[model samples]
Target: MRRRRSSGTRREGRGAPASRRQGRRRGGTDRALCGAGTRGDTPWPVDYRRSATAFLLAAALAGGAARGEGVRDPVADAVSTVSPERLAAHVARLAGFGTRHALSAGSGEGRGIDAAEAWVAARFAEIPGVEVERRRVRAFRLSGGARRVAAGWPVSSPAARFLFGLAGMGFGYREPAMSNVIARLPGREPERLILLSAHLDSRPGKRFDWRTDAPGANDDGSGVAGLLEAARALAPLPRRASVWFVAFNGEELGLLGSRQLAREIERAGLRVEAMLNLDTIGGTTTARDLPADPALPPPGTLLRVFSEGRPQHRWLDPSPRRRLAAGPSEADSPSRQLARYVRAAARRYVPDLQVELIARADRIRRGGDHFPFLRRGVAAVRFTEQREDYAHEHQDPHVENGRRYGDLPEFVDPEYMAKVTRIAVATAALLARAPRAPEEVRIDTSHLGETTTVRWRPSADPEIASYRLLARRTASPDWEIERDAGTAGEVTVALPRDDWWFAVQAVAKDGTPSLPSLAWPSDR
Candidate 1:
């Protein structure tokens, strides 16, 4: 299930931010380690309630009552519609394909990669208003150690066709057409895309085997099921930004599908606010009933979100690291902030589910479709079951010691899958409905003082009703203080200037918040 290499090799950048050990607060107000190397209580400040109230009052007085004070439950309503039975059914159907190996026959009736692709497309088309399309590209075979393209890649090069033809005849290398299934639900801001994705191909014994039962029920069938369910639920909801539900092929063959898709996205120059990859999110039961990690929540209760640390102000010149030698909070990358948002959504919508934020890019030595987009500088994260059942993933069906083995539907907990699906629905709906984050934010450090002043350019989005000032201690894992700025472009707060770091967020009238735009050191 892991094939892609980290973008660290492709892009020349500063060293990674220093690693910080995450700690859990057992008593008192749970403290969060903020991106700025500070620590503090939750983001609820003393004046937050009053400030929020004041903001609401101002909106009403300004004839914004229609947008404010209106209770909306589109996300909640969509979450409620997630069906466990449907998830299980989808998993079963995908497994029924026998195998989805990347190199499997493209033309077949009910038994190969083409059949699986068609099935997903047909399912999405059943939903009204979904514009479905297939993004097909030549799959590339990577060399050992994932250092270079061994064959069938760089097909756009002028000499690629001639070279590939020779390689096919002389070295028996074949370039297969890998397709990604994309379904879009148009919104008011159609250009800004929020992608929810999963991989479609499966491996039986090894990656190249095409004639074995590779029932990837949990490996990724569970993920694809979640995507389909989210699309069905969010299709009827109100959206401010478009949502693209995607299932990529050939992930087991080194993220080929996602690699091509990410390149296409950059080529088209679309603004992808975020990409969420759902992979191996099926069972809650651990393999051999082993003890769960002491740091993780109990099984059936935790979903792990993996995000890599990157520059907070992605558009910064000379890069974020050059501006701040310490670099952005390794824990507060844009994707990490989005992970925090998802965690918050679970608390509000799926109280029974707990989302564990894994501060690293991905599991050790393992990779997923999210890698391609992450490398491209897009905020991307991967969602997986907290406690993986090793025997149930990437294993061929067999009976060992009288116990069944393989990633089969029987091992999947549909109810758990549904809960995971609800989290995705909540996140997708919330992010799409909220205004985009402020385009620019900065902190004034011209003269060191006991106070800090923050300023930001508000989003042109009419959905933005106000702005919230966020401050976090350097040691806190999350933002600890939030105050409503009431649509102000600048706010001065008295806190020991060097002790706290800050950010600003655009807030919708409904209280939905966009990902925070970190305040960078300003030249002004």
Candidate 2:
């Protein structure tokens, strides 16, 4: 299902002469590259070379190449640690709760929402380097004419308290507040954050049926399991940016937990480098659980990553909305770039699991935890199963016309779930360790010609040792060509400015590449 594309515009500066280096160019090497002038000369954007350790590792892997950009493979090592048995165990335990509805007993004791929350929190706590905590948040009752908003109080707010006091007297009531479980692994850089999130609450039937059995083994129990697996696999991994594994509550109630979390991150002024959401990633087939598409590989081979090319803030903020009227970057927003990064990382680390970029916020009107962060201008994306089995989602445990009809452990494929979890781990680890993408990147189109010169300001991160230039035809799904433009902020590609899209990425000293920043022409 595809949606219409919306576009917006932003401005950037033109290039000025500065330091340059002789590096690989697209099509072929050009010693007189347009960007390169002299070596060791400092440009406004500080340039550095690959670290000794990175050079050693790249040489060890690439037969003495000074900087083999493709030599970063710690992600593959981390991906291998995701255990299918452990992942299955998480789903099995979550299903044991019978139901995890937001309104279910949250006393933090046994077999319900509280129990499920405690189970997830306990799993994160067991990881050696993780700091686990639970955050209290309000859950609303939207039945009747109740207003949809986050009350946030354990009991209701003062106004909500009064409303609850008058509940039987004739006003709509709200559910008791619930808590979201958070596990953090602080990194060397505390200000930078990469989050892996999933919701724990479940709903039976079309509406909230607290007493009924809604195992949610596939709906999001699979997602929560994936989060736990990733946390366990990544807990000991060294990250430059902090990594958070969050299990949210009240998702079925309208993404309440995530909404509050995003607000808090914004209020705290933390820079979220990227957020990866695992929502529904267990189903291996379509709505009826039949065979998957024959053209595609077997189960666990394909996953859907949904993202928006346009920043949600553009629609919310008046200034950008009024001034930028170009075209919606339907396939090139920060979140979309993060989506592309996930695909690239998965291809390199978890090669067996293919990522299918959905190129939309979510499926139709459906949404996930990523939306809240996206609204705050954070790059975020959602991971879901290639095809969802409707019979195993939001349905009560029962047999209708001789077919099973509830989200159950029987429907989830443990190995498939583990592969999905590994994808999240790989992407998160790569993003957390890499430097930030270049800023204010622009393409020069002062004259229409066969070649295009792209320029950008270097990342604030001093660890960035070099930059990579990427180009693809206007209609291509992936970047088809890559050039190692060593420490140069600008590069001239042989491709015509009008024939292809171009972008630049920063390469950290460790050889990890940041998500590429699309190079848009200034006049556009």
Candidate 3:
């Protein structure tokens, strides 16, 4: 869905040179490019010839299409290793657990959530360079009112009964302990993290039926399997930033595990560069009864990425007044930028799969593990199948009226799941290997002019060889143009600031581009 455009009152700066204004306001460190002159209060012309050369050089170094015929991309090689058979096997084993409900009983030997957690942990442990951590999270407790409602589920109306049953699948009165299984592949720079996550819990269509077989092979079994497969494929690669494969619990219980984990990361001051949450990413078709839309891609080839465009928490901007004065940035949230990055990476690496960027947080009121991370101001996005088959999700295995129902392994398309896993692998590997994104990115808004100027602090990574400026029209979904900023921290372009959106990315010496940071308006 498209968001309505918003307009803000324009502000004009006092009569002063752009460079002097920029330098005086933000200290002399701010760089301003003009038509001619030096580093002081003079206008410096943009070296178009040099910028074009750098762009092509960066692309070649990144192993992009510009590279020579024989160049080998370790990232592409890693993605090529995604095995459909391995993905299928992982899904089958997770589905074999019957039900991985957070409050389910069997904690002793080989059943319920505990067994599922142990199995996932063991798989990650088997990876040579990966270290597994079983993090204990707080228990999820159902509210008294929800408990009462679940207990009094009506038996009269079949439709009402089915709806209530589906709602109660993840609800329970007992306070069962939960844990998140984290697998870490430490990078050369361990402080920065790129996370790939999926929930490990499942549920049936019946209310509070933890004992019944929920075999969520497609609901989240597909996602968890994708995470495992990606981790296994990436284990042998050397990275510049850490990559984490997390299997969260209590997701069906209102995102309990992710919420706790997000809080823990915040308390510990962890810097998560980006989070790619894979959830329900295996479906290949819509329900039989639903009318088909010609616009959608034929089943298994399409994937939808949902990201929040507007900040959902107060911490992002404590002052409502300040936010209002800044005009509408509904389309520039960090998560949205990350979503665009995912689409670009997928387009470059997994050409067969179509990545559709959904300009919303999730499907209506429903959410996934990414929500908690987004609320905490982390860049996060969710991967879901293009069309969900309701008949196969949250339903138990049954043959009724000649129709089979259940989230069974047979319903999941392994080839499709592998494509999604490959996308995750490529995006994560590229982000981890690239230099950190430029910081304190800002666009000049002190004066109204036909041309726009952008500035950013240089990346601390000594390997950063150059920077790239990306821009697109306000109505566009993806970046349409790029310019090499060379080694400078600022650049001015002829495009009007009001009509264009801008972002900056740091390029490593190897030509890998970091996740782009959206530039916010700054009076200075």
**Which candidate ranks first by lDDT, i.e. highest?**
3
lDDT of 2: 0.71
| Superposition error at 187 for model 1 (Å) | 1.2
What would the per-residue lDDT of candidate 1 be over residues 212-294, giving only the tens digit for each residue? Answer: 77888888999999999999999998788999999988888777788888888889988788888999999645543866467
> TM-score of the candidate numbered 1?
0.82
Sort order, lDDT high to low: 3, 1, 2
Quote the lDDT for 78 in model 2.
79
- Which parts of model 1 are misplaced by more than 4 Å? 1-72, 140-158, 161-177, 284-288, 291-296, 310-327
**Candidate 3 on 210-308: residue-level lDDT in tens?**
777888898899999999999988988889999999999877766767878887887887788899999998864443345678875666678999987
lDDT of 2 at 281: 87
The clash tally of candidate 2 reads 4
Task: Please give each candidate's TM-score.
Answer: 0.82, 0.82, 0.81
In order of TM-score, best first, we have 1, 2, 3
Cα RMSDs of all predictions?
Answer: 8.5, 7.0, 8.5
Per-candidate local distance difference test: 0.72, 0.71, 0.74
